[model samples]
Target chain A: MDELTRARQKACAGSRLSFDEALLLYRKASLLELGQWARAAKERHSGKNVYYNINRHINLSNTCTALCPLCAFSAKQGDTRGYILSPEKVAEMISRAMQETPGLTEIHIVSSLCPDTNFSYYTDILHTVRKLLPHVHIQAFTPAEIIYFTKISGLSIKEVLQHLKDAGLSSLPGGGAEILDDSVRQIICPDKASSAEWIETMKTAHSMGIPTNSSILYGHIETTEQRLAHLFKLRAIQDETGGFGAFVSFPFYPQNTKLAELYTIKPLTAWENLKFIALSRLVLDNIDHIKAFWIMLSEEIAQLSLAFGADDLDGTVGEEKIIHAAGAKSGSIMTRKKLNDMIVQAGYIPAERDSLYNIIKQAVPS
Target chain B: MDITLDTIEDKIHSGQRLSKEDGLALYSSNDLARIGQLADSVRKKISGDYVYYNVNLHVNLTNICIGQCKFCAFGCKSSSDKAYELTKQSVLSRIAKAAEDPDMKNLHIVSGLHPDWPYEYYLDIIKTIKANFPLLHLKGFTGVEIMHFVKISGKSIETVLRELIAAGLEAMPGGGAEILDDSIRQILCPNKATSTEWLEVARTAHRLGITTNASMLYGHIETKEQRINHLLTLRALQDETGGLQTFICFPFQPKNTALEDSITRTSVWDDLKTMAISRLMLDNIHNIKAYWVMLTLPVAMLALGFGANDIDGTVGGEKIMHAAGVSSQKALSKNILIDAIREAGRIPAECDCNSKIIRTF
Candidate 1:
């Protein structure tokens, strides 16, 4: 059989696609035809349910040492706009969130690499969150942050992860895996974590019995082949570790970033976004779910993505700053009601999930 | 009969007419990119590589009106502070300043029905614009406004159109047919002309050799059958008269209007799908317009992939949709339009008010 036909048959039979086969299907298959296959793949994994969660995002700081060209949220140490939230401030925010949200499931915390803060600062924030909301899941800190923690404390990756896990780090948020290739990262996110360092960090965490999520930040400088290669890399890791709870795809938003100013860039079109979602679904056969991050892709595209093989809408992110800094407008005010209504309109059942892909609530069809 | 995208694609390939059932099927299809590709194929069949835009200005002479359209946030009571009635000189100055750019070609004037202004005042304004910029094409008014003139002056529709033509009015726009069905119009816009009267004015204007365009205001209180029938109705009229020049679809902006509390604006899916279906259904109409004022420039750029050939003008200044709380820019420059068209991988063609290609960029 030809590459595309072989790829199509493999996908229909719920088998894995190789890098070259996935790239061929991406280029040759009609958008609708591939969408049909991805839909079936998603159904075999998660059925007709589109999962969402209710979580609160607290950005601890924007002050950073390595302000990548692709990031707008990072502020230099000397910049007057730079800030590092104190433990008191973090405590107050969590207390406010606890009182405000009756059924909040997760405390989603992601921050910049502050030069002024040590390992204690990271662990203190986790301890403060665990102290306030004892039972809620704490999905904080990326592999990049974990690697940074080891550097700041002179600890190994295992020691840093163990300290944070004891203090309250439930799982990794799975960012910092931007394209998973050092050559691409050299342009968009230089001076951060290298591809080997990021995978090493995730694997170390998983070996220590910690579950983590995985992601790819596509649409910047990465090529189509690179995106496919990234997927194969993640699938191989999943096959071995089986520690990834979910996989999210974020299309690069280039509004206030230096990359945007350097080259005239338009964000991914709806066709590209849905196609990326479908491609991820077909290739990452071992991964349980493919997420359409509604924060980066707007709620409208997120709704339409349900048909294009996205089984998860991420969450009702109480507030988000990273994407908002890079020119996404869907920060704050995404209540559970709106997410439910949106999923229902897109012809899927709304499923309220925890951070680990466990359904806490399922919205019955009315 | 089973109507699927396959049948629709086959028909589009053969250049056969798409039935109402085919239009419905295309709308209900979940794969938006396929729909867009098929529409672009149909578009390339007729419009070729060139995409058309015009350098024009919109002039609203007054907001004092008798008809109380619930979907209208532009018109106002004569005594309200927001009321405006431009004198003849102001109108002339507006046109003269806009005509400063040599690229300016058409003067677009769709306004409120001033309850007090005589029919002569309307004729005089057109004559004044024509006298000043003798080369500028005067594309003004709609079918509903023509019938309003018929009511106020007690003249036939043909007489009103002929007089406007004599006074330098070159063509009419296709507004006021918010859905060519009175069952919904009676509740949505009871004070305006009925659908029958609007179609009559369109037919009469075409017979008088006045080029006109057509539009349908959708996304509020209209069924799929109604939208399809609106396209079919426009198709039949174009087949008979062959006078209609283009077609545009306005997604109803449901903010700051009576329907704001009850309905929300349609989405990009609906907008692109509707534009494609309009192209598929209205084969007799040569061009489909993606009005940047109503559909934002981004969506309009994508509409090029869905069979939209004309991106309707710079619209140097417009206020009607803004009053209804549309967030699009009040004015777009000609360079921006050219760049957008070129960025969409299509050749940009500068055109006059009526969409005749002048030069390709």
Candidate 2:
């Protein structure tokens, strides 16, 4: 009978709505109102509390050939700035993070897609990181990176993942997922992972019991439909894997990169940025955590995002270089105390956690 | 109308509020105009018809910074020949100059966290600007600089902000949020403010009733999930005090920054989609600014329909983001801004930082 009644009916039946119907909520509701509804849905599925883990990201190298236009992290093969962390060096970083933070849980390892490197090189690094810090979980590689690794290792995705898992690869980080729509991918990052490949890799990883994270790189050259398609695709996969732990949304950083030059200086609006995060929370019902990356969205929005739909703020990052190279202005490295204080300020209990979403400590404010 | 409201509530409980599934139906329905109508309707419902804009001018107090962050093209080493920090006199002069402009109602004073400036130096800067342009809305300092100022001034963040607010500081601009993902930050800005510290500053500022604007610098190496994390952080903070005045999303300007050599581009289509999505998503925030300077004029105009209500005013002189190379030079005149709004088929109105309309142009 009424719009609100219809909306409720759709929700009860788990029936989908038309875009026009969706937009009506936008016209008829406030973010607070919508969030309350979403929060209810969330609590029905997931409790109010969200999760984060104590992790370290060890990017193996910055050298790559994809040269995606939106990338501010990848360097040309021969660029003086290009670098490749030797397996020993990678292991050393892992060991240092493990030792530096005795309570460390996950070692998130990833790097630019370098054509010169092979999967054996990746396996060696994984083994090295694992050997040096036997207790730390390792969540490394994207579908693009994994596919590249498989190609280099001459193994199928399953075989490569199995080898890495045995070598201590605990999980997979959802990276290089710009938009699931191929048209946007071609315009922005043609040489990188394709939609099918990216999805397939996640699916395969899930099948292997290697829990993974999925993402959508929005605020780039894609239509509204394209962004939705990306979400639907992730939802589809999560429906299958039940392995995705979190859904992260990255905005296209149009910094001093070629994309800025080509686009003649344009970026997303703040409302758009929040909408992506909120929508991610709304659409990906299967996923548990909605994270707001401070390094990309900045600290203020990240903090505000907690109320919108996000439950988790990522851990104390020791050193972040990839997005910074893309013109991220937020600083790297936060003490445990600082993170706890932030959570408390937001009126939430801070739970120090391990990679698999295990709380190491509760209400830990430094 | 009563039934419509009820149905909307039902949709909310069903988890079919505003997902892609709905967006697809909207797009395929071949009724694109309804997109704007719905977004505008949401705008009216949440914030009313009152669109907001700030009469602010960019006053980058300094270009010197300690951290040689790879993404920055604007910050220079203090010892470098390119480095420059405005003297109080110069800063006063710039404020005076902006104050001279008839339309300049706010003065945005941001800068790199210079190594040499004492914390009092910032307080004094605020004092100087406020003393001269008492009427100007003085929104200044980023969280990074605030962190630096706290260390330099040897005072707590609350103390420094209180002192500054006493000296006429109205608000803080939320900058330096690259991504909430610490992994990305560690590699990019090891020497800058951590995500935790930045949030502390904003949260404290909010607690103090000093409203601020939040931002996100995206289109780089972060994953989609990280972006979500960034928003979640902001949302969480807003849930506390509702202190944020607006959210401004500007893409990273990579021009001559250290990151230039690493990655080379961002996109425009992504920008519009992001604006639209933001309109649909941030149901809490009152206003979203399509920063005309960062997004340029044409797209900014188009964005008004995609869910953006405010086109950031014509900045008289913009540095920092522009030195990193943004579009839209020269201050935007009221006529131009209104014309652009009218061109986009939206009513144009001049408003204060609080989204309260000062005049219907």
Name the best candidate (by TM-score): 1
DockQ of each: 0.23, 0.04
Off by over 4 Å in 2: A2-5, A8-29, A364-366, B1-48, B52-348, B351-361
Q: Across residues B109-157, which tens digit of lDDT does each residue of candidate 2 receive? A: 7788777777777778788877777777777888888888888877898
lDDT of 2 at B322: 75
- Report lDDT (Cα) of residue B109, candidate 1: 94
What is the lDDT, from 0 to 100, of the residue B356 in candidate 1?
77
Tell me the chain A TM-score of model 1: 0.97
TM-score of chain B of 2: 0.88
User: Which pairs clash in model 1?
Assistant: none
Clashes of each: 0, 113
Lowest summed lDDT across 10 adjacent residues in model 1 chain A is found at A28-37
lDDT of each: 0.86, 0.72
Candidate 2 lDDT over residue span A184-298, tens digit each:
8888888877899898888888888899888878776677777777777787788777989888888888885777777754465544565557556666767888788877876
**Candidate 1 lDDT tens digits, B103-198:** 999889998988988888899999998998899998998888898899899999989999999999888888888999999899988888998899
